[model samples]
Target: MVHPDKASTDRTCSCRINTNYIPLKLLYLFFIGGQSCATTYRSLFMRHLGMSTQQTGVIWAFERVVSVIIPPFIGALSDKSRHPKAVLITLFLVGAVTLSSMYFVPQEESLNLTNSNVSASENVTAATHVDIEEYGQTFWLLVVLVFASSFSVVGIYPVLESTVLGVLGPQNRYKFGHQRLWASVGYGGAALIVGYLKDRSAESIGDMTGTNRAFLSMFAGVMVCYCCAAIVSAKLPVRVKRDHEGFRFQDLKIFLKKPDACAFLGLLFFYGIDSAILEIYLFWLAEVKFETPSFILGASTFIGAALDIPFCLAAGYLTKRFGHKTLLCFGLGVMALRTFLSAIVVNAWQLVATESLRGITWGLMFVVICSYTSKLSPKGLEASCMGIMQAFLFGIAYSVGALAGGAIFNLMGGEFLFILCGSATFVATVAFGMFSFLVKKKPYEMKDPGDCTSSLAFGKEVAESSADVL
Candidate 1:
């Protein structure tokens, strides 16, 4: 019934929508594959290589340093080129090759002293001996490969985040919760599978050699996933080309000028320390302190990740109703409690139970933080802002935490280390809560901004409720 010209216009609109929709679907798949490779098995593989706690911490800190240096540059490059997908594809391929090469690195079994009450200096001396006598060339090779792979892997995140944001546009940006849930599914699924494989390998083959073979299988699986992710990344389409002329460090001054932004970044920095400790130390705690089996350790990860799905799905609704500050404070408070409890756990089952808190603590916190940061970013500088924020959170804060955790683990042992981290997080929570209460918004902005006004009112309510405690 339509005229030929009208019909042609309708077809063009449909084609445009399809183009954007297809890329988003592919990007989701890429997340699934990428998370499977990166999150589920990296630390376990390192442990299997006979690296001591301090040695592992040093290596991880080096990776964080690379993350600090590279992601910003990659983000800037993508901003200029207007070819984020191309950049991502290249990074994925590089990551696949470098990470796969890690499988071939030789490892000699070192002294297992995780349970000893060794001094930090003593641990360092032991680690040095292992590096020289047992690790040697293979150790340096692994470090080199990690540096190279991390340069690419860390860079991929901001680009993927930008692409997802671009695809969703302003109107539906809040719906990012739905998209992120897929990553949780991917992590959980991979953790379960990898854990089962590791347990079976240990049972069938036996000894340190069996563990080595299991780790090799895990790395191989990661390579396959990376390859699939690269293929999917290559197919993504960039809809808009942002102007990149006159870009300079001065452009970042806007964030520094805002008091709220500074407070938020500080909060993120402290939270980063807590998070890094959990990621780096929890596995060792399980294997050494509690004598938990490989399958159970993997199951713990799967449980945490699986539980994240519901929290991620509900993030948007929760943020909308309770506001960012309340959710953030609540999540941090839960984290403090989790860490304190972790310090007291005597058995593997108790540790598993404590880990369930991760769903609320990390899951909700990350979603809210990402959304908040995205909303606060200056135009055309989303990727840069994200990169800088990540550098502070994962780079500086994580490095400090990792190194200190190792030293603390060696000097004072697990209980004291957890207590220290927990106390720090608790203090941060109180400081953040006080900041939220005392920092009144300017009167010049008389017009009520819905979320901002709601957040302020919520802060006032919380302040009143805890006045005596404060």
Candidate 2:
């Protein structure tokens, strides 16, 4: 619900961009760093604790627990603050302190033992063999660090990204790709560094202590990157009213009964499953099916992701040239084609080749989704809607995607399972796509900000809004 009286049309704002270009660069870096450290680095970091597929599963599950619960809740908090920028800055500082503790936390033994059973001494995580108690202590410490670093994902991320979008407005949407391109650059660069280190030092790191030290360096690198991101985040000029929504707990009961709300969730139900397949299975197709080493997995994926830069730019152009719905359909259709191709990929080269197709679909989807979400954002609850989107939908999607993807691999065999993922994407796309079209009532006009007094809380609304983006 947007307040019709809220004269704060984001496009019309005149706040000065005192620290403009450089902060934008830092924003890109921090955005990438925040995502990689908070979500992507978990696999490598888990190995250091000698976690098993199951133990690692548990750790990730725990992290997802917070991700599922906190982001939207905190998003509500961000929506109301007089200065959401301040809240974002504070989150970074808190994350820095929490993440720093990873340098000194004890390891978890039970998880480490599981990893050893799965992989040999050489194959196991470097710290796996340190006495179980020490490992347990560190693992527990990591649980805290994971929670802390997640500030970027759970709440602060929407706050920060919304701030960037608020500044860029509709005019500069084309540049959004450029910003995300920097994120791909950071990940690709990090991957190269990690690959070089692992290849060059694999033999010398035969000793457990040496392995542990190397993994620590990786963690430290992630922290350094995040620190730089925090610096960039401090300087963006974002202006939006900050006040809590008036929706209450009772509204939560009938929240979905609203027509647009029902249609939106229905669209997401399948969209999420399809999106989850790509998130989890693509890497599997590359790493496992192709027998690509873990060290270079990031590098290979980054190569494919690098292709997304052009797609992102193209997406911006197409979205602006055509419309949000058109590009989204195109992107989803491309993904469907890619999924179909992935099922039959026979080698690493084939996988890489087809994986290149991923950029257009993924890049287009991202830009379209973000743009659409921005259009529907209520006057003040921008972060809240974004939070519900990332956490409630995609957060759950990622977690289930990981576990379910693995199960699919085991049940159907990797090739067949991947094929199934592609098919699901295709079928679900049609289903969800139709629903998206069905919800075209003037969702925005029906619900004004005044209608959504504090009686409403965060993302739940009687009409379609930003949460529909996910």
Candidate 3:
């Protein structure tokens, strides 16, 4: 019984909402579902695969090396082609395939060669057999797959951030925090689910075989999530303006001229080192030192991620009121305090308690740094600027940090490692706070003035202005 005119108006409104609102909501869902599969289970999977602490560090270092080399090229390609959504979908598909391959790699069987009455010749034979079977084809295949998947997947965040920034603009940049809170929810929920599954499996089948099987299943689930992410990414609206300007080498030089940008990058580098150490070693600390159950280990992550939800949801409002620089310094300071507290933990529960600080530190740091980077970027080169920032933070800084932290852990144990990283983070926080004093803030204009309907009059004025300039 609706009138034709009313029906037509309703349809138009629906289209506008679909075009504007749904796409961003889907991006938020993408973060939630995608991170649940990737970050929540990756370290646990590697540990289940029997990688030692040092060996795990080497693999992560190599992965970061790939992250360093690939993201910049991908960023530039996204800018020049103006098809970032397509690029993101392609990367997700490739990453899914590579990640799935890891689960199928065969596990090497351990050899027990000890015997009281074995002859020298028999001992030699056993030694040769053990050497041949240990770390064979399957082990190296997993390493290669990890590197390949990491290279494909690591560029995702910067591109996604660029797309979000394009849609939100500088004035509405605070909304980015609330959007990212969904990712925290996804990560926490996924960790809890995976943890419960692993615990049940272990109870039914015993720890060794059960945990390994659970790890394989987790990787399989990650593949499915990545596929879903690819589908969602395809639907994302593209708004970044594409010009014939192509990629310019000078675009890279723009950040160099700004001292504030340089200082921010430096702070990111040191903090990257601190974060890398924690990511690589935290579970190892819990498992080896505290002898925590696998489910409890996962619960700790869940708790930390859950804490992030509220902080991230409020980050935009806080940033707007207190300023990005203040938040940045505050986040780094929290990290320093968290690291110092983590160094003194005597029990698994205490470690979990310290992890609650992650909400204030990591959740706040990522949102603010990303929004601030977008604010600082030139009008057209947003993706490239983010890419460069990530390259510095996740690439060079992460690699050095992982390698050095591994070596330090091997030589000096966890106490010294924590102390060292905590001290360095504290120093960086102080430096960044001091550097902020020299940088002047500029007011941002949110409205576009070029949307007049008198095209003929605008065209005539443009032609006359061009002739005068000539």
TM-score of each: 0.83, 0.71, 0.81
Q: Rank the candidates by lDDT, best first.
A: 1, 3, 2
Error of 2 at 228 (Å): 0.7
For model 2, residues 17-56, the per-residue Cα lDDT tens digits are: 3245446656666656545543444454555454433344
The candidate, 1 or 3, that scores higher on TM-score is 1
Candidate 2 or 3, higher lDDT? 3
Candidate 3, residues 217-304, lDDT tens digits: the string is: 5666678778877887887766877562444557779976778788888888887888888877877766768777767776777789
**Compared with the true structure, what per-residue lDDT tens digits does model 1 show for residues 1-470?**
99999988865553333345445545554555555555456665666665656666777788887777776778778878888778888888898788778887766444564446887557656655565446556557778998998878888887788777767555445545556665666666676677788778777777765236766556666777677777777766556655553235675797677787788888887788888788788777767677677677767777877788778766766776876777888888888888888888888878678878888987778888886675566765555677778878878888888878877876788788888999999999999889988998433221222222234533432332222111
Native-to-model Cα distance after best TM-score fit, residue 283 in candidate 1, in Å: 0.7
Worst 10 residues of 1 by lDDT: 461-470
The C-alpha stretches of model 3 lying farther than 4 A from their native spots are 1-19, 108-139, 169-171, 207-211, 244-247, 438-470
Q: Which candidate tops lDDT?
A: 1
Candidate 2: list runs displaced more than 4 Å.
1-21, 97-144, 169-178, 207-210, 240-291, 336-344, 376-383, 406-417, 433-470
